[model samples]
Each structure stands twice: as C-alpha cells, then as structure tokens.
Target chain A: MREPTVRTQKIKKDTTRTRLIFFGILALILIICSVFCEYLTPYDPYLQDLKNAKAPPSLSHLFGTDRYGRDMLSRVIVGSKASIFSTLLLVGLVTVLGTMAGVFGGWHGKRIDTVLMRISDMFLAFPGLVFAMAVAGVLGGGLQNAIIALMAISWPKYARIARSETLVQKEAPYLKAARLSGSGTLKIVFKHILPNIIGPILVTSMLDIGTMMMELAGLSFLGLGAKPPTAEWGSRMSDARSLLSSAPWVTLSPGVAIFISVMIFNLLGDTIRDYADPKSRGR
Target chain B: MDQPALKVSHLTKVFTRKGQPDFTAVDHVSFSIQAGECAGLIGESGSGKTTVVNMITRLLDPTGGSIVLNGEDITRMRGKELRKVYARMQMVFQTPAESFDPRCTLGDGIGESLRNNGRSRRETRDEVARLMEVCGLSADFASRYPHQVSGGECQRAAIARALAIKPRLLICDEATSSLDVTIQKEIIALLNKLRREKDSDLSILFICHDIALVQQFCNRVLVLYKGKIVEQGEVDAVIRNPQDPYTRRLIDSIL
Candidate 1:
C-alpha cells in the first residue's frame, strides 16, 4: 500500500472534480428553454408572414424569419420540446430494456447469455444511422416511425454495455458474499450489481441522448420526421440550405441551437461520470 | 461417535481448457469436522484450499463430489434448495474490505442475512447490534460504510454478518490473512471466544497457510499440497511431528 502508485492514480481520478457545473448550467438553460418556450417568446413560431419571409436577424424578430416568415428564434426554442421529450423517452426505454436483458444474460450465462449477446451483436453489426434510416423508410415517414426505428437500433449498445458490466459486477466479492448469505439472483443483481454499474450506465445514457437528438434531427431533415409546418431545427436548417447565399441565419440559428444542445449533453455526461465515481470529486 | 458437522467426500475440480488437456485443481480430497470442532485446512497458494471452500460454500459447483452438512447433501442442490443451505453454512471471505457492498452501510450488510431468514426489520436490527457487540465492534459503527471503517473493523463486521443467521458451520477462507498482525490475533481471539460460549455449537473450517496460528486455534489440522491432502491429524500432534516434507517446509516458513 505504501508505493501503489496505480492505486493512487485511480483514487485521484475517482475523487477529482472537473468543474462540470458550467456544463450543468448550459444543459439546464436548454431544458428551461425547451420547457418554457411558449411563455418566453415574443412571436408565434408557426405564424408564417410571406411579407416578412427570409428576413435577416432583426431587433423585432430576433433570429429573423424563415422562408415562411416564422420567427427562427421562436421556432428553434419551441421545436426543442419534441426532441428533448423523445430523447428522454428513448433513453429511459433503452436503459430499462438493455439493463434487464444484460442483467439476466450475465446472471444466467451459458445459453441465455449467448442468445442475448448474439442478438445485440446482430443489431450492432449494422452502421447505426443506416439501420435506423432503413427501419424508418420501411415504416413510412413520421416522427413516431423514426423514433421507433431509432429505439430498435439504439438498444443493442446499452444491452452490450450492461451485459459486460454485469458480468464483471456479478464476480465482485460482495455479490459472492451475498450468495453465501443466501441472497437470490434478483437480490444480487439489483441490490449489488446494479448500484455499482449505475454511474457508467448513466454516463452512457446522457452521451447517447445527444446522439438521439441528432438522429431525430437527421430524420426530420430527410422529411421522414416531424411533418411540414412543424418548425423542427433539422428541417428548419434543411429548408434554408438552398438560400445559404442570401439568409444564412435561417440555417445558422438552428445549426447553432443543435450544436449547443448536443455539447451540453456530452459535457453533462463527462461531469456525471466524474462525479459518480467515488474517487473523483467535482471541481 | 457424534455425527460430524460437515462431511466433504471425494471432492474434485478439473479446469478444462480449449484445445488442451484439463488441469486438475483438486483431486479426491475428503475431510469432516465434528460438531463444535475447529478444523484448520492448511495449504500454500494454488494448493486448492480456496477452491475447496468455494465448492463447499456452493459458490463454485464442483466437477464431482458430495458435501453433507449435518446429514443433508448439498452437492447437487439448485435454486431454492441451494439458497436454503446457505443460511445453515456461511463463508467468511479473505478480504474483509471487499466483503461488503460499497453502497451498503455495515448495518445493512449484517442485517441482510437476518432479513433473508425472515426476521422482522426491528428484530434484524436488534440481532445485528448484538452480533456486532459479540464481534467486539461498537454499535454506532454499524451506520458506516465499508470504506469508511478500518480493515480490522470491516473484518469484525464481516464476522458478524457471517454469524448473523447463526450458521452451524463457518467456512473461514483465509479470513484473517488480509488483516495486520495485531488485528489477526484479535480476530483469532474473537473466534475462540465464540467457540467457548457453550450454547453456540459453531464449527469452523479455518483455511490458512499460518501453521502456528492453526496450532493455537484448531483442534484438528489437514495439510494440502498440489490439490492433495498430504497430511492431517490433531493440530498439536501435526505441529510436534510434521511427517510430510511439505508440511515441515510450511511450518519452517512460518514467520
């Protein structure tokens, strides 16, 4: 214990607090903006005024207007609600489904582990976005279809992660002692294994929410997501791609919104991973 | 003669490898402890002592063997049956620091066995407090997590947890090896006190490489080498005359 430098390094990393409050603040603002967009805006996000169409960033309009004369700022703020809500739902579903599958697979190895893991491997074999696009295409166009497609492809990542983590967790000394104390598989998996791996799982979920947001936006851009007049950021940006030379704010505003939101989630993930680790305290 | 508390006969474990011959970790090992007796299984690292303990505790299913605890065969027990056998016999792990869940307080860790045994929450707390005292720990320390306490205190908590359901056989798998010399002696003293309490007929399968410690603690001793029981007898007799060369070496290496 005197010269175990590796142990010291690990402890230092676990306890170190990398100032993540900045990321938290950024994420919180996005959440607040999404949740309270209706009350915070001066203009209706969907009110298309052809007379003011393609207006540049102005004092009255703020982020100017899109091709349809809808306020870009208001649209970006309001459209986020759907993306955030869907991301939360997708994340929650993925975590529950994946962890349950993984815990079961890892606990009852042999045939069960092989079967569960192989199915996930099949899901993982496809390039994630391409597989999702294919599913969405087959299911026809709509936000609901796109979400279903995204969920179908996304779950395997969590399942694989949970399974591997559970395999390691089940071997921990406490769990073995729990077994020696007459605890059943359910008790050991939930009480012992799940708590230990929850930090990593949370980190995974947070980072992936950013990915899910981007995916939802991508589907929208391709006309297979939020229908017309919806004013989603990705579709909003796509509509302005042809008018790039004239009104850049139409595309740039939504692009910036997407970038900031995604960065906030990613940073939030790093902060959580650092803070949740017993060795790492936050700055 | 009184029936033995534990009977492990022809216990064997073979580690099969991919595209290679299997490694026999333990071969035809057999031993038994009489009720209220303290039996020490002495062996060096890789000598299959831990494997034997793992099999007996049912953590690792043996390749072939029968383990009978107080007249019940637990060798092939599965699911609910195996879980039932757990309360009757418990294993104290080598590393006390790792014996408890990091998320759980010492009180929760100790009270888990009682809860499994269907003791009410209030009753479990009372029993855990009493067990903590029996293991020489203060009641207030029960609220602390494993990492919050010292190694010696954690080991005492581990002992209390093992004894929570009042198991007849306690499989101590090099339990005191991870503690400091002072703490090691303290743990040994605690076990001795438990044995002398008269009402608790606790049988211990104490696994250790420390021949001198076994001589002080165990009534009977079994020496293992390369997965075989090379020598075994009454602890005093084996120490006074270690017939096997490996046993002599083990005794000589004792610091």
Candidate 2:
C-alpha cells in the first residue's frame, strides 16, 4: 500500500511539473510573439483595403477583414504586444511600489504605518474599474494613461498583502535572531525579511496578471485606453463590435486572442502558486 | 577582577495600552553575570522571566533603568552602536526551529553574523562547518533547512549560529525546553563542552523554569517572581538554604 502511494505521489509531482513547464513555455511564447509581432504578421495590420472590406475568413485573410479591410489575424497578432506588455508593466510597477511601501510601513510601524495604511485603505475603498475610468477620463484617452489609472487603484492590494506578510515576518524569531546577530536594519529587511515575505507577494502578483490584462482591455473597450489605430486587443474588439452579427470573425479574432493569453497566464499563475506552497506539491 | 560579562540594574518594562492600566512586566529587576559564569534565571510562567530576558537582549525597550554589557552602558545605544553591542551578546531562543530563517539553509544562518562582520564567503563556510561540528552536528546538515532536520539537530544548529561570532555573553532563553529528555541532556552536555573549551572568555545567561536543570548546569541562580528577583546566590547555596518565601515555595514544589 505504501509503495503504491509513493508511486502515485511521484506521478502527481510529475503532473504538476509538466503543467508548470507547459504553461510557462506557452506564456513565454506569447511574450516572444508580442516582442517580434511585426515580423510574425503576414500583412500590414494598419493598411486599409476598402475592396476586401468585411471579407470573411479565407485563404488570403485567415481571420477575415475588418470594415477597413485591415487583416484581423495580423491585427490580433500585433495587438498582443500592447495588451500583454502593458499588463506586465503594470503588474511590475505595482508590485515594486507596493512591496516597498509595505515593508517600510511594517518595519518602521508607528505614525508612518498608520498614514500609509490609511491611504491604501482609501484606495481600496474605491471600486477599481470605476476609479480607473475616472482617472483615465481626467488623464485623457491613451494606453499609458489607462495603465496609470489602473495602476493607481491596483497598487493598494499589493501593499496590503506585503504589509500583512511583513507584519507577520517582522515578529518572527529568526528576525530577532538576525537582529541579535548584529545585522543592520537594511540587511535584516533586504536579506531576511524581504526574501521570506516575497513568496506570498509573488504569488499574488502572478495571479493579478490575468485581472490586470482584462481590466486594461476593458478600459480600451470603453474608449479610455489604446486610442484608435493602435491595434490593441481591446480596441480591436471595440472597433469590430458593430460587425458582431454580420462579420463576427473580426470581433471574435481579438476576443479569442485575449481568451487564450488570459487562460495561459492564469493557468501559469495557478501552477506557480501550487508549486510555491509546499503543502500542495504532493497532492 | 575584570568586568562582569552582563549587568542589569533596576531594569523595568511597563506595557502601556490606550484605555487600559499600564502593566508592569519586569519591575526593578537587577542581576549580573561574571565572566565564565552560567547564571540561571529561574521562575514560573508569567513571572516576567522572559520579559527580563527580552529587555536585556534589547528585543524590548526597558521602561527604565540600565543594562551594562562588558562594562559598557548599552541602555541608550541604537543603530550602529547597538549593532556593535550585538557582536558581544547573542541569544538562543526557546524554539530552535523557529529561531532559524526557514528560507535560509543552516549554513547561511550560522554564517550570517560572520558574513555581516566582513568575513568572506569561503571563510564563513569554513567557520560554519567547524561550528556545526563543534555543536555535534555533521557538516552535511549545513545544507538542510530548519524543517528538514530533527528538533535536536536544529537546536544544535541554533547553538552553532549563536557561537559563530564567539560572543562574550550567550543568552539561552529556554534553549533546551522544547527537546525530549535525552536530547535536552545532549544539548546541555554540548553547552558544557563549549563552556569548558571557551574557559573564562565565555559567559552564559541560561534562562529556564526547570529548577533541577538549572541547579545541575548553572553556577549562580536568580529566582524571579512578579518581575522581581526574589532570591539569588550560588546554585548550591540557594538549593540548600532557601531565602525568600517565594524561593522556599519554588524549592518545596520541586522537592
């Protein structure tokens, strides 16, 4: 019985490893395609051909043409750059800024903690997309402003996670031992505290990727992000929304692209979360 | 003849909470440990034994009074100066596994102080190996995480980490309390061997509630009750002739 259980456990471990690698590679491929999307496109995503307008999926135009006769497949391929990279940049920005604020607040933890945490609470109190829309409306329509708007609301979540994690880690006996061993405040925070607290923070960030992507796309769909002719996934979907019944391929092309990318990223995040937590590794 | 390794005079800690009365944890507690001495602070739970230890180790700020280590008044020390004082004094906590950073290997934990003090990676590695061996842990155990090792092994690793800097005063705050009897004895023996090897250069403040264990290991013992040092003397003398009523009750309970 024990031998069979051990064998089954090994199999489970192998399955998790496979899922991790598979999703990891898929995510990498998406990133690489985005980076070199120009070369990968079969036709100019921006070039207009009124004669081939609203042409359905065919040998020449694989995902059909939009009302402007721009190749939908090429447009979706190019849109990956704006869609994926912006989400990544947003997640990176929030994680660093929030983690720093949180670590500082937790470590110092007096008037500073109260002030910073209250500010974070204020941010958390706002409905995320509505607040982002308001900020985007003020900042004016563009991908950067939309990102900046979303960033304003998203950072507080990371800050809260980092703060709570840091608070728990700050009182850990190992930290006390480190302090007693003559490690300075900076060394203790960077070397000991940060490393220990990072696991949860990383998992949180990984899980946020899909959400940020959707939010960014939602902003673009709402005309608050990636203005006309930029070939962003959300904007492409927005541009083809009118043709939904007649030439559904135009809208579905970018929608499908968004779906696949989001699924890959979300699955990757799930796999990473499972792998990072030791308790979940066996099962 | 020389200065005592650690000295505490009128050390006090009062926990102040908003809308609540200030509670005195350690009140006017005073004690000193001479060089090469193993001084035990014995008290029941809630007697402020750990509170006194915390104040001395600088883990908690003293509400009043002073702590002198190796004749230097460190009561007001902070930042660089406080860190400098940390080199001379170190603490081994109650739970050995919890006292080690789970993310770090045993070697890194043991070598942290040495690395902080400007020892190169190679030197720290060599020193960590030697310290682990001295603490009766094999060199291979250095690669293991805190959870990977048994409680006794982790305790040994904790001891090695404490001794890495060759601190003049080592504070063991119930260091062996979590271990089984046999393992506890082994740890005590290991500490004894280390003290013998370090000779008069080392001083130990062994905090424990087990009076029998304290009597066997410590040279001098301070009995604490309600944050006050109720009785104190050479271990043998105090055991034979109980002084304070609290001390008498403590002895009677054990006898």
Q: Pick the candidate with the highest DockQ.
A: 2
In angstroms, give how far residue B143 of model 2 lies from its true place. Answer: 1.2
Q: What share of the true interface contacts does each candidate keep?
A: 0.68, 0.87
lDDT tens string, model 2, A117-175? Answer: 99998998999999999999999999999989998998888888888889999989999
Report DockQ per prediction, comma-separated. 0.65, 0.78
Alpha-carbon shift of residue B98 in model 2 (angstroms): 0.6
Instruction: Calculate the i-RMS of every candidate, to one decimal place.
Output: 0.8, 0.8
lDDT of 2 by residue, B197-228 (tens): 99888899999999999999999999999989
Which CAPRI tier for candidate 1? Answer: medium
Model 1 chain A: lowest-lDDT 10 consecutive positions: A7-16
For this target, which candidate reaches the highest lDDT against the unseen true structure?
2
* Model 1 C-alpha lDDT versus the unseen true structure: 0.87
lDDT of 1 at B96: 94
